[model samples]
Target: MKSETVGSATLETWSVEEVEQAFAANEIVLIDVRTPQEYIFEHIEGALLMPMAFFKAEKLPGQTEKRIVLHCGSGIRSEKMARLAIDAGVTKIAHMDGGFGAWKTAKKPYIGTDMASGAPKRVG
Candidate 1:
């Protein structure tokens, strides 16, 4: 775990492995802070979309006790979202290391949307 101060709030970060394990165990809420188009192209299985362009902390799912893991195409957007979350009084927050890019490079399993059929496609 790593912590940093952004503005008046503090944000925490977790490694991809740690996040993956937690996600598999259903111990955390995975959020994809990317655009709808980006999400339609590809995304982690079970990740909820909360596009940074219109992100609202209240829109974040899970209870305060539940760990909220945020990710983006890369680490940048998620980091920004984390700051926004923290500023909104969300205490249990974490950003995925390297974001979705790292998760994909690691060959971790994911699901992509079929543009034509508008269905989900599971891939690894």
Candidate 2:
């Protein structure tokens, strides 16, 4: 994990592998801050869709036992949101570095769309 400063807040940026492991261990609440369209195309399994356009830091559930991790298409949007969360007085929050793209590059399992069937399919 790497830490980045956004304003006065320090955001923890985690690699895809780290996020994958935490997810597999049920140690994190993975949130996808991408658009609904993007999420419909493909997304990490069990990731909650909280589109950046309408996301509010206050909307995040208080997760004392589990870490709240954010992710997007790339690392950009998620980091932005993480900063917002921190600024909103959320003491603990993390964003996935390199986002879904990196996860795909790492060959992590995710739910993808089937164009013909218009259904969710598992991809690794």
| lDDT leader | 2
lDDT of 2 by residue, 74-94 (tens): 899999999889989887789
Worst 10 residues of 1 by lDDT: 58-67
* TM-score: model 2 vs. ground truth: 0.94
lDDT of 1 by residue, 1-124 (tens): 7888766656888888999999999888898999999998888878899899999997787565568889998899998888778778876578988999999999999988776898989987
TM-score of each: 0.85, 0.94
Residue 5 shift from truth in candidate 2, angstroms: 4.9
Off by over 4 Å in 1: 5-10, 113-119
On TM-score, the leading prediction is: 2
Clashing pairs in 1: none
